[model samples]
Target: MIEQTKCNAILQKEAESFRNTSRRTFIKRLAGGTAVIAAAPYISCGKAGDSFEALKESAGALSTGNIGDEAFWREVKKQFIIDKKLIVMNAANLSPSPVPVMEILFELTRDVDRDASSQNRSKFSTLRQQTREAVAAYIGADPEEVAIVRNTSEGNNMVINGLSLNKGDEVVIWDQNHPTLNVAWDVRAERYGFTVKKVGTPLKPQTAEDLVEPFRDAITNRTKVLAFSDISNITGVRLPENELCAMARDAGIITVIDGAQSIGAMNLNMHDIGCDFYTCSSHKWMMGPREAGILYVKKEHITDLYPSIVGVGWEGAIGSGTARKFETLGQQANERIAAFGKTVEFLDAIGKDRIEARILSIAAALRDGISKRVPGVEFYNPQNREMSGGIVKFASPEIDLSDAGSTLYETYGIVCSVHGGNFPGIRLSTHIYNTMEEIEKATEAAAGLV
Candidate 1:
């Protein structure tokens, strides 16, 4: 304890000294060449001083550096086990977990497997609470409002099934919602005889109002729910969530936000957004283990929604009525939940603002590269920062986007999403792990195809 306190004191002094350092120099130095992982980036809870030192060492790779510096992100990329031979740009679908998260996941899983008993596994209950608290803090919500679940789909469905609806009650949803949020409502509407109205926005939204006005105009007296995605995987349009949520609240309607693509890639404050319900999959932008998710319900409305799946943990006690009641699904992968806490811890160590800036920087670089190199490149994603994020979608009449994904992978070992239909294009999602070098190479590969 003495040694840990001394280390923290030293770290605090160092941090104070570095406060005046230029932001550019900070990013440049931090983005220095990849260094060996000496420790995970966590210093609290009385961990050994060496652990703190190790975290500092690991963080050195991302030390004072600019987001445009390939050397800096290249170091950040080293923390993952992604293949060096491939240029993976599909953060919209999945991301690789960092070394610390994977390590704890394996270690705890092995410990559980070695002795699966009430006596040995009792700590997981506390760990689960810690997980919820970590996720809650990350999203700026109360721990009681956060429910650890399986994925975005499950969370969305929980809100869909938990809410009370009746015949002729209309739910307004954005047309660009993921199938889970879009089709799941239809399934329930079919059985319950409610109306599902999907409001459409222009493919290339010119402004935030272009995205917001459609949903704002869609609401009516019968609109009981307004469900939408903060960032759409299909069109890559980032909705004006705060405006939309406030609109719903004013209309006395519930708001359910599918944050599948927004949570980890951007800085989010659930309370500030004031949505009634929010759901996120940790596997995508969070780079946590699969089958892990988070569900946030406003404290006021927790009692109004029913638990979609109730089992061993379900209780009639007042204490049980919290968001925990919503997570009463049978036995869960406790190891993943434990690892998820580490995932949140890792992200916290890096700082969400830093992560968001890095992602946007790379996406901007990609857009600029494609426009300059690829002929007739037409972007589907809104160029405005308010209506777009790390996901960039574009197409060229000279190239066939339907087969662009396979071709990029086969020819250049680059992985990206290719969307077909009315909006046929290639989608490249940049995260902290991606590099300027990879983005440049992808642009070159795309130019050749054109």
Candidate 2:
């Protein structure tokens, strides 16, 4: 208890210092002083200190310019450790963590390695709660409503396997959901004898209603759950999640949002969306640590949903009436959890709305550049800003998408992904780290493939 209190006090002091001091001054102080982790005897100020300084400098620089200005975003780009030559436009799949997040991860990992004794590791419990609180606040959720899970896949499965779906109950999901959310439902349904129905939206949705009505129409009397991605990774279609969740609520159906594409890419409020459960990956848009994710179960539904993993903490979690029950998975990456909190801090420091706008601006530029350069290019994602996030999916009939994706990376240093299955196209998902010039180069390289 004493150690935990000391850790909390140190964390509180650091947080206050971070807020009160100027960014440059804070960076200097942070680099020169012991970090919050240093509250534990086994931990020390090391590479994480240097990385924190770089992050603060970059963040301090970004605060000076207009959101739309390229120079402003260049400062944001400096926060990342991505190579200068490579232009990575696939935040939907994975993202490179900023220097600070990586440094914390490295530092904490070494802390654990230095002393695996229970005495040395006891502080993680306090740190875990801190991360939960930070993550919940960032997403407009309660600390008790949030669980730090592995990734979106684990969270989705927890909701999938944990929900009380009996035979004959139906689950309605969007066709564009990631395979984990889509196929996993089918897999569970096959064993449990529940129905899994997929709703397909228009290829080019003209309005928000165009995206919402399909799922609205798909739900029936037997439907017990509505599952869909906030933004489709395949087509880059941003679903009207609030509308869909509201509709499901009116019908007394559980709403599960797979937020792999939308979480850190936009300003999100889980309370406003009114989902019974929400899941997201930090490795994608949040750019935190790999294998870290969030699961939010509404307070009322906490006891109803069973935990998928029952390990060390299960005894207390089972009746806790909190989302902690879901995170009873044994032996988590404690270092990543600490860094996840740092990720939320980083994103919160840079206003969520600002980040979203920067991403949308880059996406809009890419879409426009591609349309102008490649004649007869077919865009799978909606053109309207309201109907999409940062993901821009398009295909030119003249060019082979597989070859175009390779050529973009191999020749132009523009990294993108190709999808050949149902959604056959080239996908370019940009983020704050990307620049308009890189988008232009990608546009030209893609056009050259045609």
Q: Which of the numbered candidates is closest to the native, going by highest lDDT?
A: 2
TM-score of 2: 0.88
* TM values, all candidates: 0.86, 0.88
For model 1, how does the per-residue alpha-carbon lDDT over 109-159 read when each residue is reduced to its tens digit? 655665678766677777788789889999999999999999999999999
Model 1 TM-score on a 0 to 1 scale: 0.86
Q: Residue 422, candidate 1: how far off, in angstroms?
A: 2.9
Using TM-score as the measure, which candidate wins?
Answer: 2
Tens-digit per-residue lDDT, 1-450, candidate 2 = 665676457555555543454434422332333343432332122222223444445555655444647765666676676767799999999998866676567656755675677866676777778789889999999999999999999999999999998898999999999988999999999899999999999998999999888888888999999999999999998998989989999999999999999999999999998999999999999998999999999999998887788899787877777888888888878878877887887787677888888899889999999999987899998879999999999987888775777788888888778889988989999998898888888888878888
- Evaluated at residue 84, the lDDT of candidate 2 is 72
* Candidate 1 lDDT: 0.81
